[model samples]
Target chain A: MNLNIEVNNNVLTAMPGDTILDALNRHGMNVPTLCHLKGLMPSGACRMCVVEVEGRKNLVTSCSEPVMDGMKIQTHSARVIESRKTIVELLLSNHPDDCLYCERNGSCELQKLAEDLNVRERRISGNKNNYKLDVSSASIVRDPAKCILCGRCVRVCEEIEGVSAIEFVGRGSKTFIDTSFNHGLNVSTCVNCGQCIMVCPTGALKEKPHIDEIKTKLADPTKTVVIQYAPSITISLAEEFGFKPGQNIGGIMNAALRRIGFNFVFDTSFSADLTIMEEASELVHRITTGGTLPMITSCCPGWVKYAEEFQHDILPNLSSCKSPQQMMGAIIKSYFAEAEGINPADIYSVSVMPCTAKKFEQQREEMTQNGISDVDAVLTTRELARLIRLFGIDMDKISPELADSPLGTRSSAGKIFGVSGGVMEAAIRSAHYFITGKELIKFQVNAVRGLAGRKEAKVMINGLEIGVAVVSGLKNAEILMEEVRNGRKDIHFIEVMACPGGCINGGGQPIGTNEESLRARMKSLYEIDEHDAIKVSHKNPYIIELYDKFLGKPLGHKSHHLLHTNYQERDVN
Target chain B: MKSKVEEILQQYPNAGRDSLIPILQSVQESLGFLSEESVVQVSKFLKMPASKIFGVATFYNQFRFTQPGKYHVMVCRGTACHVLGSATVLEEIEKYLKVKPGMTTKDKIFSLEVVACIGACGLAPVISINGEFHAKVTTESIQSIFETYRNREV
Candidate 1:
């Protein structure tokens, strides 16, 4: 084999160790792929990318085939197209024919492939296998009938999240993805991260939607339905309404929710500020009072559940603060209810979040009070978009509206809770102030700011140099956890977000999201941080006023009762 | 059962991920099948999930998931046996036993398994009761074959 390959009479250079698809892609030629995921080892399970080689008798899967020197390649020859089109038609033969009512009707890769390959006729019709829908998981719903057996969800759950909750069960035509013992996902070691939902190309995996339940609650006049949206939700929700990737649609979202008959709209960033106040105070107290060193952040429910299941020993190292969504829900049920003279039971608290695990997080035992859940319903960012569309509210015509007062205001520190390292940056700002009574000169901590799965930084406050690490993605978190388990010191605080790049890239954010959108969302969050006036959580007036009136101090008795919680080890695995 | 699973895991103290199939086979050999408890212990030892372990176990038809009964039955489904009407003979055993392949009887009296080819095709359409071959099995012969084992004490 030579160093150069001829593709359709054009000479193309092949890099060492480059796959045929990689070389073609580098030369601006694109071949469709179904089971291929970037940054993962190619399994060549799906033959969607078949290319013709000069001397080869049969077509080869370009994703797994290495480029040979002095080779003639035809990417879309007649034979290759026939093979691809036939493959799609065969896959559709057994696939359920319910695209209109399917959750992934618009975004499904299989449907798109059928259209792309012009597979208009059912030349190869076969019997459709009926599969039982698995809706046992709190955060995700699984419809096995719609699955194309691409194995993307299985691979992502195993390679990226390291959860391996689902696997390719059985063999041959009888093969399908299933949990252990075929006993649904609830009994499996699934952490409810929703990452599999994000990677799934079809509607087989989706967030367990609360939109229908939320609509019933909204129509009830006797119930006061108030909604709270996570900090990352505003920027990510724009893409669903034909807006830009990182457009901040908070104001329009507020107006839309109110127009949809929500009694009040609250920003979860307010409680994010509340969380920072308590979490930073807890970190400082741990340092000075000789409490557990290197207190990990418990803001991401996916990470919390992961630690509970996988890292049981590190439970004490986790901060006792509830996540921002749950914290806001707790306050809304307790303080907001009493102040407004409304019964907590009559108030149906709804939260819109970017992460699916927040759905599971809000339903946690400690997230409720007196048999009533703090957050009655949890809608994903995608679900919130569907709700807005269901109401026929045109977001383009809606004007920017402010969040309701008392429990609605927040600082930039609270707003930055959307991105991966945002929690650590916000907490560091407050922890610095809590330790030395002075804020840091630079609010943006550059070391922990990028989309890298893991990052580490250090800060000097009053001659005490403290080390901190920020990690996103459970697989990366597993590596850091190994070091911590092996007795690594010098790191005082660690922040972990289960989804890669944090809430902006959460499982419930949006379908058909790409790398560019993720980067754009992160940029928009930082741009907001760079310009906002109140840059620290302590400076939020609502938080300050709450401390003075409702709560005595951060980590105080009342704050502990409402804003803090504990975690118990789960033996699901 | 947990301690016994622990003992099997102890045999592969320095085992890694690749040792999974061998270890699973060993456990199945001892326990007659891969029990949920054994799967959990193997998962913990390999630092993997039981779901993945189950997937691998189900891929090959060799592994069983249910305990074998006192009289384990194997029916050959090879090309020779299949052409000679083993399908009907197997169906008769399933109907008489009231259990599917890879499943045991409710009373733990019999466990029936369908094998792709046990290489006993010289006497086509064969059935084995406790490794004792009843060559040239017929559909009507299944009842009398089970009656022979049903009346016998362990």
Candidate 2:
């Protein structure tokens, strides 16, 4: 299977499965590539790797073309160079020359490729296709003009995460990646997972800007700016500051927030434990009262948005309890504000999440029950990284500090809520306790753990079998729904998270999370859970105190007024 | 024998506006044309106004609401096909038919349309006449293809 290849007049040896690019790279030839990410397959769309292959009619994209025996490949022949130049020029024709003001100017792959290819001027004079920038979500932006239609976003959504929210619509020059029925991301079945922004080559996808608002708040002497960091953020945030992925910089993160001049620093995990108490009670009540079967977890904002958009018919299946962040927001305004004797309006509750959909979720009119939004502005992990750098905080050199008390002391079940299947496991822990009134000997529910695209498990509770299904990706959710529509076996409960690895790998988290980082982060999450003294949410003293003081109890009249929400059917057409 | 309209209605049980293009395309591919009876069946199955369906079928370039010519000539305008001078081949086809793209000859011998990438970029400048691919096409090749179709008609 050995092949003798002559690329760029230099002889090289290759194997049967080696691509033309692979052979050239082995020979120390540096060819330009943009869409060839290490983990993903080469899409051959950039056309920068064009090479003239002997016996082939035209220049073939070397990244996709396999090496054959005695193949004479010309990597930089006049025709091949011309083809590459033309492709680069065509790409440049639509690209704006606003790199000076761009956030990712020097770091952008597309910008570097244009410079490497020496594209001084665009040969084509076609008008650039213009689109109104979409800043509706907190963590992501959509600038269609900057998009090259390389389909890196679409590929990542489908291949990496198993969600196909964005797809190529129309033909040729008119083609662009759009949500189904050409609707906006807010209206479409988009989970706002922000993975698309991470893989995007240009500024077409970016984190929603909240630095200005934060700066304004920091400048105000009267208003108190409170920031709460999700549990998963600490494990993933270090990667953005050049620390290796899954490096524990929790103390450093707390210090950074303190350095950022926030009036109060809190942890969402405290509210996460509270969410478990409420969600767990709801699950038990449904089981006892013969309510909706397969009650879905509504913690992940992206999954909730997807449920509202495409699965409106199944709204009754969604848990009535608000997400941990929203629950935290509500608690901060009502309980914390009342306890401190401060005006709820003056206290700005900001949640730092590894998700973009939380931004949109916060803006929903229903979320503003107590006159003001429970959560104000939201920031992704990357946005927080940018803010940290702006404040001149050396994240590595800083010492870690503990999160604020009362709302910061959280159980192991609360910490695990950052990862996929964590919500189901947390609910099950509390549900088991609430139903049996005795602690389950085995806390770990192996049935609902892992990164399975579609996972299902059955547990017998009080002689009643409860069927549960976990869906991480929206497309996988679609497949599961299709099965349900086709009269598949009825289930008692389901948990759906939009992101593949759930909130830990949220769209707003730092990119470049490889297999090693994923494994490390997952390990940290389980470690956090196992090392904790309180593994169950129902056992959390703070949650019990909150229920006794303010909310009364789970599904109480006050809890229902502030924490529950209804879904609306979206017009797909 | 069941009318062509009845045959179409049997194929699409729950016809709607969304299925109109696919159904009409399927009917045209099978019967080689849209007949009065088939149109009625489409109207009935889709529960759509016949005039509305007809309007849509005629608007899209892919739809063939009327009868096709004796010869179905599709010149690919895909990126690969265009790079290999399929435009010139199409021009030669127009010269022979004395008509433009998406037109049928008075003699009902030739019809033409430019299709997007047919996924046959390896063999550039491809032309398909009655579902047969003729790769690496030229004016001479197009002329020969037309003559072959004309002879078959005769």
Candidate 3:
């Protein structure tokens, strides 16, 4: 039943269990909120959403208060506005005075709230917090001094990600969010998914940017700086450059990177095609040779780390194929360098990823071969956009160009690897070929597609029924894995991406991207897949050539050394 | 200490959210304080985040994170005690014992605690040395009180 209520003299209807904030939002009445995250339980800790109600002595936080029948509320009374202004001013008093240099300078929610409420002068003055920045994690940075104690990061980490790597420590005014025992995140069971950075309203939580390292390598003439962009980056990168979201700026991005002093630029999708050739062959080998059943995709480094920490027993189940970025790095240093007669040590390989975990992934010991690391520096899609701006390149005037040859060609199946179920769909296409020696009539496995946290399907390939599951977000993956651990032998293959919507919504992409932008980016990939002639990775000419000339075959001796790696169990403690 | 915590945790085979406070209380009562190890154990037992356990434990004054000394000293800082120069008495005790509130003396003879009120308004400006209340305590009386507890047998 719906209850009729009056908000600021307007009659509104609210459903049962709807908070006052919910009713107000339904009526298009906006109230200032900081600690309140939609789809999460209302915390009411911020007190910025307080509204006056008739017969109530004190202002009540609309987010936590349920709308009762005939409850007259004043959402924007002078008193309420004054109270919200004071709350913002108090937060500013203790916050650091580094907005000019902060990562969220132009996009900070708290700063925007101050502007909305017209908070000009600071009425309250207090000593600023002197907490040291926690820079231990390769993916994220924690600046406690800038934290406003909104508890958004803590809630998102615990509630959504199900990785309670951080929580509020101490009490009252001395309170701050930190991992258990105040140790840095490297010691904690942090999966490095970067969800905390995605929800942070302020600059308190941010990706550990590698812009300077990329620039330093670019300036060094001895280092032949080469960069590769992830499959999802081209679609999502447009949003940062003032272009509409999901505009395929792949060609323009290539033109921009060349102007920024890059010696060469390649597509990670090419290696994604290469990854499929290896991944599908490995799956086929497992199925035929009585190897580990239910092989899990290890493309997402964040998920690999999660498996290492929480589900060590499942480590053997993870595919040994390195992520497309790492695979590209491996080939570039060995195969690409050999072709050009350049010393591998003199080459600086950089990757522009749609993920923050790639920064951690490139530094993995397994990713290095014979004293040379595959990839040198990893930059987020946001960092690439920042570099483009730093070079003062005019995006509008630049002509569209193609990526460098040799490693430039990729198939539509490889391009779809940016989204959640993309890897499984791509692998199934090629795995069918590997097993039956013929391509499937239908290229797309419609069952394993979209933004759902988890998807499962059964496919008959060469009369062998293969059970497959695709999961995004580690929490969702844990549920599917628990079923697998219980000896449920139906599933034979699994794909796990730590980021909820896959690399399109990766942590390293443009920050503050909503659902609309995610759909747009995902749609762009699907469109590219639909229009391209080469839809199967096994059919890509370069991949076939690479296997014939340099490598003997998929899962062969040289392929194993250059492209594959192993993972070890890690202690959460 | 480890066995005691494990025993308490074992009592609740499938503890949920509601069992946290009682578990914390039981652990603190048995061990005289909640250690980091006990907190971690309780978090695992209840399936609660350690930060939440610490947050809940710190909210109540009954739970102490550190061990209490053999002779726990409590000086009242309530309104009635403050009106009777209890601040000076507390300062004198801290100076003579060389320990601040919530800290134990090097010799383990005394530990200082600043309590809000002991509900003995008539005995204003009172200091309790190991639960033995001293009424109408003054700055000069703190030194003699320390001497009395320091020389006592274990």
Off by over 4 Å in 1: A1-4
Ranking of all predicted structures according to DockQ, beginning with the best and ending with the worst: 1, 3, 2
Question: DockQ of candidates 1 onward, in order?
Answer: 0.80, 0.03, 0.38
TM-score on 0 to 1 scale for chain A of candidate 3: 0.97
TM-score of 3: 0.90
Best by DockQ: 1
As for candidate 3, its clashing pairs are A294-A492
Better structure of 1 and 3 per TM-score: 1
Q: How does each model score on TM-score?
A: 0.97, 0.73, 0.90
Model with the higher DockQ, candidate 1 or 3: 1
Higher-scoring candidate on TM-score, 2 or 3 = 3
Interface RMSD of the predictions, in order shown? 0.8, 11.6, 2.2
DockQ of 3: 0.38
Off by over 4 Å in 2: A1-43, A49-59, A62-86, A114-130, A136-139, A155-171, A177-184, A460-465, B1-154
lDDT of 2 by residue, B6-108 (tens): 6766777666679888788778878877665576577657754344455455556676544677667788899888887988888888887897876678887
True C-alpha contacts between chains kept, each model in order: 0.82, 0.00, 0.38
